[model samples]
Target: MAIPVTAIFDIGKTNKKFFLFDENLRELHHEYFKLTPTLDDDGFECDDIYVLCNWIQNTVRKITSSGEYQLKRLNFSTYGATLVHLDADGKPVTPLYNYLKPFPDDICDQFYKQYPQDEHNLHTASPALGMLNAGLQLYWLKYTKPQVFQRIRYTLHFPQYLSYLFTGQLVSEPTSIGCHTKLWDFSRNRYHDWVYTEKIDHLLPEIVPASKTFQTIIGGHAVKVGVGIHDSSSALAAYMMRTQEPFALISTGTWSITLNPYTKESLTRDELNRDCLNFLTIEGKPVKASRLFLGHELDHHLRILNDIFHKEARYYKQIKLQDSFLKKIHNHELTPSFYPATIANPLLSQDVFSSDNWKPNNFESYEEAYHHLIWGLTLLQVASARLALGNSDVKKIYIDGGFIDNDIFIKLLQYYLPNYTIEVSHMPLGSAHGAAMIMQGKQVELVV
Candidate 1:
């Protein structure tokens, strides 16, 4: 008998990736494809459902027929805050709306007026973050696009939608439902009453546990399809399998999110305003997390330096600026106290002058100039991480993602956060690996 293999469809906004892992959670093969957005009849930007559906079908067929591996189970881990509407026939009735689409202003006003900001915040345990709140998207469609809304038979979160593509079943999983979607009542541990009160409960698919499994046959192979999980939560699951002690994870990428799985306290308004939010674990528990736009800012500043000095940004090596230069840049008139610690503002001239902005006017080497830039970026990241730490008893900070490869950034972070022991995670495929691990009732061994 052949060993059982699990296939994971890890879907992101830009890339749709597939991975096949054996029963021991070892990756066998992986493939990825980019998805293009298509305009709907009204010229609104939406995902090409047909393209995604066809790709998934073709990939599954090809993988199952390879004869190199026997497929036994399948699972999905995808980005959150997007939904797909299915018709009575289990077919998508409308274009998968992009979460990037703006929410209507009138609806926002009406929603706040009806529920009051504080009441709604307390009820949902979610901050009002423009389009990031998936529940608001449903409200937008109901009020602004009634025609499309009326035709919907069921709505599934993005990960669940991917699972539905293969299982031919519409089910909502906890990980997707519990994201900052404002759909689930975290305090009550059930769907919010507004779902039924607003008559939109019919749109929701049947709820299922994240670890629940369903049987499906594909290409003469019997496969167990597990309910989907959110990518962040999946990553956490993979990490938890390796460690039993309380620890915090800094998942770095476009956004550096510091997650404290042990912090179960409800978020206050100030924390929400600072970009802190709750994530639902695969087991349907709230995981407190705070996000910082460090990666975005770093790239922005690097590009600005590249343009100004006509040099590509070097990230791997450490750059140390002279004490005099650092002092001068810190005291420079261009530096603003309120300069947002985010990469949203790229123009160095508009914010603070770092080593990146230091031309040969007085500096001796390019290394010095680069060091200044690193100093500023590192300082911002440290401050952001401290804010995310809050009052949580985070003993060890596990850094993962692109920044872990940068020695200069890590060293600077180590210097600033001297109180906590910093460790870089070796897990390469975190979220996808976590999804695969959860399916087999196994855990990832932590590498120190």
Candidate 2:
């Protein structure tokens, strides 16, 4: 007999994954792929939606026909701050623009001037992220490409778009809407006023709970298809289901995000300025979050250091935190902070470290310099994490993703947050697992 299973598509910016889990949520199969991105009309790189769509359809057909498992359900967990615009006949009308693509400064300046208080609007929980705020993408399109915008009958967040390809259903969910997209008004619990004002709300599909699914027939089999979820929220859902206590999650990747689902305090403007925002759970409750460009900063500086120190790319992975090195930093024996004490800035900058930004004379060895880098980032991370923590009496912090394997990063975090229990999460599959759980209607309520 074929084992009953659920199929989940966990799509990240660089890695697109497909996974199968048996009835007991045990992994049955997993496939990973790296699709080459295509360029937008203006030559900016973006996801090739057609290529991704074909891969999904082809993968499903191959698996369903394999007979190794019964594909009972289908769902998706994808990166947020991206959208796919569809025409009236449900055909894509534009490229899947990269979230990092620059949003014109003039338009951004004009937007704030119009909605003077929006920058500090806690109700939206969106910072001035320009293109990173997906709603502004629609605004940019409407103003710059009115002809293309006119053709857009609907716009679905990346995850929902993937779900729509299979289920043929048009819908939205809280996880995507509330992920610093600037579309959701958390206080009002509806679309933001700017959305309605710009008439961008019309292009958005109907809103649905993240756990809601549609009964569909796929490849001659009945399937429960989820509306889909943002990757971060999906990962948090996995922890919420198992962990009974209130805690913060430091989900690291290109961006290191500290998430606190238990914070009761409202997001202050000061917090917003410090890069703190809120993400919604699958249930539409706000989860306070703080962001830091950790991985990006580390990668950038590591390249410079590798050249200066004549070390391999992966050398830093083996470096561990040394107490004596940390003590020098704490005792002010190390003159001039390598990275700025500013929590909102990147992990490392030349501004405060040395005159030319980087000076080889600052350190005797590559390992010593690496230790300083980690310590500096950890100092900023402590502040960022505290912003998310608020007054919540959370005693545990779970660090997940790429940095979990970085000993220096993990150790420094533990040292800085001595009052809390710091743990490295082994759940790299948390997002995929969480997507499956939502499809199974097994979402557990998390009490703060």
* lDDT string, candidate 1, 349-375, tens digits: 232333343333343445554565566
Worst 10 residues of 2 by lDDT: 342-351
Report clash pairs, candidate 1: 297-343
Best by lDDT: 2
Error of 1 at 210 (Å): 1.3
Candidate 2 per-residue C-alpha lDDT over 139-169 given as tens digits, one digit per residue, 9 for 90 to 100: 8998899999999999999999999988888
The Cα RMSD in angstroms, rounded to one decimal, for candidate 2 relative to the true structure is 3.1
Candidate number achieving the greatest TM-score relative to the actual structure: 2
